[model samples]
Target: MTFTLAIVGRPNVGKSTLFNRLVGKRLALVDDQPGVTRDLREGEARLGPLRFTVIDTAGLEEATDESLQGRMRKLTERAVEMADACLFLIDARAGVLPTDEVFADILRRKNAHVILAANKSEGRAAEAGLIEAWGLGLGEPLALSAEHGEGMAELAAVLTPIAEEMAERAARVAAEAPETDVSVSDEDDDEAVRKPTRARPLQVAVVGRPNAGKSTLINKLIGEERLLTGPEAGITRDSISLAFDWGDVPTRIFDTAGMRKKAKVQEKLEKLSVADGLRAVKFAEVVIVLLDAAIPFEQQDLRIADLAEREGRAVVVAVNKWDAERHKQEKLSELREAFERLLPQLRGAPLVTISAKTGKGLDRLHAAVMRAHETWNARVSTARLNRWLEGMVSAHPPPAPGGRRIRLRYMTQVKTRPPGFVVMCSHPDKLPESYSRYLINGLRDDFDMPGTPIRLHMRSQAEKNPYKDKKNWGAPSRLRKHLDKPKPKKG
Candidate 1:
């Protein structure tokens, strides 16, 4: 029931400035350049009592076939269609230009509810341009300085009515719907009843190469002698799931058998243990891939991370035995750089250095797990997604091979257990693997979906069948005709 407002305009019109003002945070990277924000950034916005979703779009510009601008235009159009209203921003000091006119035309054609905002209207120089904005035919201009935070009260007044109407309509629609068992009940308002039904504690499987301090780290996090501690490789045979809480958060820690090269894994029980550990990864929401601080970023460690990514699980890297190591700073930095370079998919992923024996950095490790879990459940609005998509297309337009440019129509998140998305397009098969990687990287960087695997699927328009048109699908026409023929003259 959230009313969505998209701030859209040509480059350098202070859209990001206003976004920072409304969101009340510097979430979007702001710069003086026209296209510093090459992604659609979204935040929960509040203007007085009004609460709605706000989207910041990239700077609009002209584009040629297979050019970035063209892709950006397509992205913006999708955002406009998804939004309930749009704030068409104009640089008051610069006055209305041909790009503004073109965008205004586009907004009008979309029939989206719009408010014309003349940003940077604090000084005397902006007065004339603010007056000139009235001719854009988008009603009275709301003149305000995003940098100085002027005219926010007036912006609230403008948005109040729209917000109220949207809220009321949503309530009415919700009132007509049937309720389910999971729906909150008035009688179950007490603390005991309100507590979330905790599922079977998350099954976490810690897997890495031999002598990776898997048992030591597990013992340190749980503060118990649950697993046998030894310097010998492969001390544990079977994968074990132990119930424990990490700072009030319930967790099931699985100490698994250490994996080695396939040629070295000769024992029958060892092979079974490896398969069992992998199954645990598939079931887990968050997997802590422990690495020895001395030999961090080994090929085996990369393979473990890749497996976790492929399995669509949240991952956190814990560089253990840091207390005993010399040159700790250098090693930590090296580990981080290698992570970024080798595993671009897990951008912004948490990397913690800890001493398993001393329990150092365990608090940070726990925090990282919680953060990764939240990001794994994150959902983006369709409007904001399209806006971000537009910026990406503008930055790097999709490739064309045979004079026919690829058209990415729309993207919608179909599932979120593993954060899967489906992008509807004209030619699903024609998209290159590199382009898919590019989009995935953008998603990870912009949305803060680090240390998690994201699934992107392309679907063709021709494959969809909405109506299910088929002969004799419902009631036959002959049966309807017989019924209409007066019941066979009353028999």
Candidate 2:
């Protein structure tokens, strides 16, 4: 098992800055404003020779009630419980506040290993705060500037022993575990051969409008309160990804910030958050467009699903909060009708009803996701595709433009994963967009690839004029001379 480290501190104490440095990427959004990070963000961190998983938690707050701040505090405390070690950070410039002292004491009682650090300790102004950090009494306070990359060597040195200790503990646990009998029949061996050598984690991103239960659904899927979820509309600011096993399938799921209309996204932080979520969608192989059942298939929801379709990603529409719905069958039928009418481009896509709070309909959601993925990656043999194309063209022949007949000669699938195809034809430029849509729809229906994006490209493959470059190519020499002589006599 890899060592786990949690960086916990008050807001704007440069916790995100240090996280970015250690991870060697600007993953977590950093701003001068406090509470820029509300959800817990995890990344693989590396410092010199040490490598481990590091979690950037929400800024520790003193709130104990059910408000947003209180919810954030509870999430951070959960991180402290799960981590192998905690790095208690304080702003050296501001010295130690009462909140810092209170959190430090809580860490001492809860966590066995705690390392205190005074950030922004690069200058003389932070000297007093560094001394104050030591008074917290967790341990010797390491003075470092997260932004300036100072004290990284000292931090790495301190973490080396902790890594070794974790490795030792893991070894002991492995040694004490029971071993299975090593017996393989011929059938077992053949079954093993049929299995894949390795399966990479599937990349899935859940996105929707604000207050659509995106975060809550993800938390339910992972079976943990990993993401900060409450009655708040925009509790998630960063697109946090969590790697876990979803019913025996390894998956990396992204919980993205709720996307709103472009005109309404006025704040700088919100803009960044939305952009981050968009990036996640681009990288994802499958996207689940979450919808609030009460106001399902709104303009924003349709736009989101269409965006996923345009990106050539597998899409599954999930109506969340179904447990609260009053009329189930009528709502389902209405939703289906609206889905087909408003978003015909994604016709035949899976529409599932789910309740993130009650964990109902998740199995169906999982099956739909897997089915969509399979369809997205489906490939058609070139011979089969050509046969189907011939039948389609025979059934509805190409239209003639300007009294000249257009020919459809050949067709083949060019790629998969949101399958692409190329058709060899006469006057590709003259092909109408409606005709192209006709072919795409045919492919989706005949090939059983419903709802996945299909790309069709027309290419003119007419052979070059064979005799254009040759001399005396038009007629025989004698015939050419006779024609020239006749012309002179007539004059």
Candidate 3:
């Protein structure tokens, strides 16, 4: 179960900083300038064992209800209402002002679970402001330095009980009415999974560098001239998504502007177009990184692929304009090698060579997409996962560092929809990148999972295991220990 928390405060109170601290990443852009974050950015946050969805809202300011700032405040209020709890941040250095009081009144009227956080409280300078926070009447204020991470443990303690309560309630609800998948025939499945009738169609965004045949390919797939296409570059300005069906699958396809080198994009519209395209990529479940066959792997193309990987979205590489290439066989082989060399993170990804203009390999492209999507949604049983882990360990044993061979004892798929696996092992942080890649590639090949991105996370089990002291005993541990142990004396 997951709960939602909204971080609300006036401008430049380090809301974004606190958000980055909670999410354990700099996902929200943090700038010293006020109002840098104008929109609400959400991320999965974790503190110790507590996990929840956290929203970083835009800073509030005084304005009329019709003004932009007023609208942003309304949005923040809506977020506060939707969240199970709210983290009301105040800059302890700046001290409590009228804006903070006004927001405090608003929060009090809402009667939401508010955790007053006194940010920037690292030194004597912030002491008076921290004392002033008591006037808000919310509760005991948590003196925190979001940037320096001074009081995260205290904040986590406050949030843990609320999170546990929400989790328990969710468990009860889930227990009362368990969800079961009801398989339906293809014909019936259409109605069951139709966009308008059922859930919203999965959004898929096709993005790449300029002249990657993005518009042409989208037209080919939709079987219509929905978007303007030409040999000239920069034809599409806005990122547009169209709803269509491929066989039985209902999908929303986003045709985006040709992304160029940041320096090359000078015009205001072009900048907006690029931003819109990125928004599409962020929102989409899967993104197809279209590469022009002529220039298969450009620097920008690799950047786009890296961005998708960083964003945790499933990706498929489509080599567009394949029919136009004169040296087809050699070029395809070269492209494959380059893909392997450049974007190794997407190793074993689906790379389909298709002519968007001629529609030569449309069926193959669709099949590749469907296969990748399935792999993205793939889940493996615990028994099968352990068996695969055993095989992986046997193939290429982890190298010993400091006379201790690393042991990977257990593996489990933590989440799917771009399957993420967690492997419990000794010195998880020390696991070589090459070894991790080997495991991931093996999983892809063994499971017939192609195209979709797979995440293999390693976690240390230092104190969790009770048999750490007995290095040479215990049957269950001995079995795993033997796998890594050097071959017994040949004699």
Among these predictions, the greatest TM-score belongs to: 2
**Clash pairs of candidate 1?**
40-388, 68-394
Q: lDDT per prediction?
A: 0.79, 0.91, 0.82
Q: How well is each residue in 428-453 modelled by candidate 3, as lDDT tens digits? A: 76778999989888988898776567
Query: Candidate 3: TM-score?
Result: 0.55
Could you list the CA RMSD of all candidates, in the order they appear?
29.9, 3.5, 15.9
Query: After TM-score superposition, what is the CA distance of residue 94 in candidate 2 from its true location, in Å?
Result: 0.4
Question: Which candidate has the highest lDDT of all?
Answer: 2
lDDT of 2 by residue, 1-491 (tens): 57999999999999999999999999999999999999999999999989999999999988999999999999999999999999999999999999898998999998998999999998799989987887898878998899999999999999999999999999999999998755565456532442222256788999999989999898899988888888879889999999888787778999999999999999999999999999999999899999999998888898999999999999999999999999999999999999999999998899999999999999999999988888887878889988998899999988888877778888888777688999999999988888999999999899898888888999999989988997556888788766566455564
Q: Which stretches of candidate 1 lie over 4 Å from their true place?
A: 1-197, 463-491
Using all chains and alpha carbons, the TM-scores for the candidates as numbered come to: 0.55, 0.93, 0.55
- Which rank order by lDDT, best down to worst? 2, 3, 1
Clashing pairs in 3: 350-451
